[model samples]
Target chain A: MTALIAGAASTTFGKHDDLSARELFRDAAEAAIGLVSLTAVDIDAVYVGNFMGALTDDQGHMGALMADYLGIPDVPTATVESACASSGTAVSRAVDAIDAGQADVVLVGGVEMMYATGIAVITDALANAADNEYENEAGLTFPGIYALMAREYMNTYDVSEEDLAQVAVKNRRNGVSNPISQFQEEVTIEEVLEARPIAPPLGLFDCCPITDGASALIVVSPEFAANHGLSPDVRIAGRGQAGDTLALQDREDMGRTRAAERAAERAYTAAGIVPEDIDVCEVHDCFTIAELLAVESLGLCERGEGATLTTTGETAKEGRIPVNTSGGLIAKGHPVGATGVAQLVEIVKQLEGRHPNQVPDSAIGVTHNVGGSGASAVVHVLEVAG
Target chain B: MTASWYESFAAAVDREEPQYRRCAACGESGLPPRQTCPTCGEPEMIDAPLSMSATVVAATEIHVTTPKFEGEAPYTVVIAEFDENVRLTGQLSGNEDVRPGDGVTVGVERREDWPPVITFTPS
Candidate 1:
């Protein structure tokens, strides 16, 4: 089973002017399909990754909606939801389908139009990802869950508030060059430090904006691509996913994400590459502290070294190992379901040497997308092979 | 978004105030009830009344406030760990001079929609 990513595309990730949820998905799908040699009818199936279309737009059955709009009415379609990693999971499933010889070509898309919903509704929608009986019933929102981790990380690692603020400053600075990012302006550490507080130790700037966007990717077997007169830019060498307890309290350790560690390990093994082999990474930086933890969890840095890396510019675009070169969720905007696919879109561009904010000569790129305070993690490693 | 638990708990405690659950097994208490003994995993949890008294385990002052809690800018949030490993996190109460391991207590403060959060007051 030879699997390769033939094409990828995403809308600029801020709140769009007049796009509906279906339109957002359709536009991204069109962009991806246009780049590939195959038409909508050639695709075997459609997989949509969306978390809150039902509550946010009164639109469920997203798979059917996208397939119908794209004129692939008879193809099988399904929507996957695993919090923010929904699209990543969708991509994983598409890869599986091709690997299993079940599909020759698949269209994987992720979209979220969160701006249409109010704050309370959005909060409720996100809260649905948590343990309904345990965490959500107790008034624990997503921010509150990460807040607990931030506090624990600070206590155990002695990471200062200033260090966490540096993450927001750095990611926003990276966002400045990203045309699709929601925030184009660079922010200062001082500004981040002084921003209004959402949860304790986490300010408004520390949290990712409720973004509206969609991203799509065309995954085909390498054999199929060759037979169809298509060129493969990047090979999906490694993909791994792991799930943990939904409630943060269920974890034995608060500072570490076990699911991330396990997924990264499996991905590296499957790709036959070590962490040092990765030239670039697109991680789940839904929160500033999350980026810090991701660096550590992905083995880019040792535990407790993430803050130091951010503070010293090690994770900067030109630094030793550039993380979140796509502005991350911080400034890139997080349309939960769209985030994972967006990460892959950026990485594929980097591998294809097409990224505007390209990491010079990036050969091996990895993406890590997590859901609900690290309850679920999907890690995929991609490489450019001639 | 009114405080359903706040009014009922305050009425039960009969002090015009909110209360937390205490582990009948360990005597540890928090605003949001703990299900099992965090230290021992004992299921002998019971409702225990608590006062706004605790010490800050870790504290950071937040300047940016979200739309839901806009007026409370520059508020302090602290992770307050009590005896028996029962830890609670909330905004700091009183004059926000908080530090790790500083003794503190809980303070009843209303947010926009929910019941009063378990704010921390320096003990």
Candidate 2:
């Protein structure tokens, strides 16, 4: 039993001062269900991915609330939380329910509203993802954590700041074509280098902006899609999730994300596909340096060469192996929980040839979502169903 | 609320000598006390004074910090490994130049309103 995506939609990833996380989720879910031409009666269950709703919105039991808001209060509901990979984790669960014949169709998505609060609150909330006692207590935030990795990577690979700035420049360029992207303007290498340092060796442009958005995916078993006379254009080819030590100091290597490596390997084996088989990919570019590490950890490039790839334009939208054509979290805005589901939406659009910046002949795609400094990771492979 | 692992480190730091925990059964040495040995299912652990000097394996200068760390922005944080397996994180005493593999000495530092924290300085 394979799960196929029937429909996908996402709200623009940016500040939504007027909407709460629930309202954003509602908008995305309604639009997504509309895409499939489904009613509340069609959804059997709802899985909501949320990272900090409790802290930010003071809301929990989101599963029931979301289902109720969708006018399907009786449906079984569960809220998945894995920090940044919350929605990605939710997608995996939805796929499991359908694959095991437990459900025919499921509404799986992620939502986060961070603009209601200030950066101070959001930073503290995000810090909960790291080791509260060891890492966060040491006054390290996400930017500082990734900055550590960037520094080590630079020293190990003999890479320079300009090499990393290329990633920021490339993703921003891709974001220009994405109407839903938070930052549609492109940046230059010099500008990135000159940007105010958020964490030394990592400037303002190196980090993903705080965002508020929601994304939803309607997944159904192949039979369900067929019974409804709907074409299953995209199929879940492979899925994998892995975990690692929460604290970077506990890990032996900070240069690589072990969880991503493990997840990508499992996903590739399950899909019977290699890196070369992937035509397009949307990786977790939560940080510019993260983009570099993600490519290497996914085996899309060699270790210590991720920066080189960025510098040579290999990971650009027009490069040899296009990555993050949706502008990624860098320019796409990371709503944390919604990022995973949003990644899949971009991949599906590319495969359907409906993406604004289409990767020519993109048939196979991969999405990598990481939670909290690579402590957890989920990898999914998607392909055109023909 | 003080975490179990922080007890030994915090206590030692207050005494002006930093310490790390070693699982008595498996001989795994690190900081931030664990109730049980991660490598071996042993609950017995011992605290020992860590080597005053260590090597910085990773370092970063955080320009923006969390609310708890307000006014401490632009501080340098480093992960230093001591006695081969014992690794810990601390803020450098000053905006000193620190690099991977740079030798440093660990100690304790107290800020006006914050709790005692581990501090590292170039050895």
Candidate 3:
């Protein structure tokens, strides 16, 4: 009853200034549909994930719009939004529907048109994900929020900024190998430490860019995949979604993303596997420190040992765990809504042995995506199907 | 039920007083008061008092900000605590170098057209 991902693709995940959100989605959707033998008319359900379209692109009602662009306007479709986890939730819903015998040959797409409106407007739109009444009113931005988390963590863990900068150093290194990555050049730890400051203890290198892009996945039931003689590998093994307080202040522990921990626990349980079995991961590295927190939250390592992975180069593509091999959100560019689906796309590329930064012999992969300030989270486990 | 929570709290700040939502049953306290206890899910909570004396639990200086704080880059934000473990997230008015465990006092600006702006001034 598992939902198998037959085809996946993404438009280059950097600035797509010439493209509209729906246009970008169409490009990705068409590319994804082109990969499989099925046509757009074969898709029975469509779920599109989008955020800030109303503000950035002056567009709304993305689900129907995307379907219409794909020439399948009659399908049942809806837009899903859970902040940055929007597409993650969309894919989650698609998996459930196929698992429940509701439908087969579902199309899931995630897109964000951010570069159109410029940074100030985009920043404000991004803030819509936080608690407006409190966090936003207090002039706290996402960088500030994550910086606060990093500060507390550093204070308690006795970790230094150099240790933190290594995350950017590692991910940017991997970014150079990823064709869709926003940053193609490698950065030294010193350069990262000396980079322009976005928030104290977090240099500009530490944050993900405001990207404009879209990604897509064609998910079908196992029966449909088998019937069509589709690619036999890459099935959605497990998925879990969880939420926490919208405001960061309400959390008992500011340094820990409880939502990610819970979501990963559920995902791992559903997959019948442990963190150690994960051959690779595409985590929500919206920030450098985020990757550290993400690995810990995924239980890929112990609480404070993420720094070890970064410093020892274990999370690099050629290393043990090969985290963020697709350059992650930090380098791959986080088009908010598109991020979660794109993460899965990267995992599929890795599991299929064709990623730009392929990890050798990678069979099991995980995608961890979290919304603003660790409020909402979704985790998915994908593996080479038997 | 907590519709007037922000206004009441802002008004109290204007009167040189501040209050926070406290769950008497669970002894849990929080800010931007919720309709129910964040911890115990209780129906009602008391507007417990918040003191000027608070300690910084976490602090971050934002080198870039959103449009609301345009031309106000390089600002500090902190999570500070009052008595009863009540916490508030706000801007740091001064002492940009302050870090965790620093001494600070809450400062709130009440407004009619906008939400109250809260800050923590290093003590």
Candidate 4:
């Protein structure tokens, strides 16, 4: 509760052959530190959010690596990984340190370089987030995991493929304006439907691409901000993180995301704001069905009403509540560890009224980030501090 | 890995018997065995054998496969809610057109150098 976001920055989400993982973090880290006019020495600790560095990037011990790379090698540091929610959890940890009176300023950054791993190798690596002995061994993939939910969703509800395709249409339209987004060009629902199937009900267009990007945020104690004569309008109002069963077969209702619902409930109570109070939002749309599940879990709409909400154009930027204004993970790019921090970046931008696709008079925003198959979900509510 | 919990389930998979854990305390059934009952944290769970009959709950024909499944591309995966009230996710055996609510029989394909693959046949 005492943490205030001093600075935020991110590398463009997509292919990056020029920079290593540590280098990517450096760029974002230096920029974020510079945003509030501080050197690395001012940061009391470093929290790095990274996943799959050892398997794909041949780099492990990310905390020490990123800290040493940023010329702050001696600070206490740790690498946090909850699959894709790594950075989101990392940010939460930094805030906790501030609330616990451990540190004045903490540097949190998330980075992943997956584009170099290629499809075959990366596909298997990403599935490590699932239950490897059962789910992966049984041929279940990340897309397949989401596809299973999509199937149950369709069979139980009066939904069709066309209904899910609307998510891509709206997000792709939003991506066209986000320079950091991976897929800038828009695609029609016809293109979404006609696209080759990855898993039934989810096509190549429905899934998030393998991305290489990084995001960084400088979190400070209220006293530190005052001592430095820096007043931040954006503060983390409330945050909630929860877990669910790792595999899909274990879930009682495949249609619902229990972790997100629980996490959002805790966050809403913490922030003292309801879903209706949210002006702009960003969610982990790892798959099109994921966005629907997220909105329902976050209470944006009723259960089983996400697809209908999209069909009504209420989730679009110009609609009642602008969701995924940063193109979401579907279009913005999901660099696993960086996604949570990246979602926070988008939310902060909207709260600052400086977003590339800014909404009118937006003072409150929320970010929903979930790891593989809803096993890990973290929701944070950011508000403009007076 | 206290894999003793999984040994019975693995043995059942190897023998192709339909078995799942039932909490001795609460009678809740679970698959992909765990050390304790997920519902009540009961340590005494018995592996109740089943008749292998099941119904299709959901199915997806996967075109994009992982590195392991890449060699065996384009296979249908099914979540079958067995008659015993436990669900198993596996590949559809022989694929004779299955939709939700269709009756099916559970099977396991075990081979050397590969993990056990759960399969379902429409009945």
Q: Each model's C-alpha lDDT? A: 0.81, 0.89, 0.86, 0.88
Candidate structures ordered by DockQ, highest first:
3, 4, 2, 1
Using alpha carbons, what is the TM-score of model 4? Answer: 0.97
TM-score of each: 0.82, 0.96, 0.97, 0.97
True-vs-predicted CA distance for residue A215, candidate 3, Å: 0.3
- Which run of 10 residues does model 4 chain A get worst, by summed lDDT? A132-141
lDDT of 1 by residue, A4-97 (tens): 8888999989877588988989999999989987788899989999999988888899999999999998998999889999999999999989
Measured by lDDT, the strongest candidate is 2
Whole-model lDDT, model 3: 0.86
- Fnat for each predicted structure, in order: 0.13, 0.70, 0.90, 0.73
Per-prediction DockQ, in order? 0.15, 0.71, 0.81, 0.72
Please state the CAPRI-style docking class of candidate 2: medium
lDDT, candidate 4, at A346: 87
lDDT, candidate 3, at A246: 90
Q: Summarize candidate 4's per-residue lDDT along B3-111 as a digit string, tens digits.
A: 4544456567657685787888998887645658888999988877876778888888878778778868788888888766787787887848789999887777776
The order of the candidates by lDDT, greatest first, is: 2, 4, 3, 1
- Show the colliding residue pairs in model 4: none
Model 2, position A74, has a per-residue lDDT of 92
**Model 1 bad stretches (over 4 Å):** B1-123
DockQ-superior candidate, 2 or 4: 4
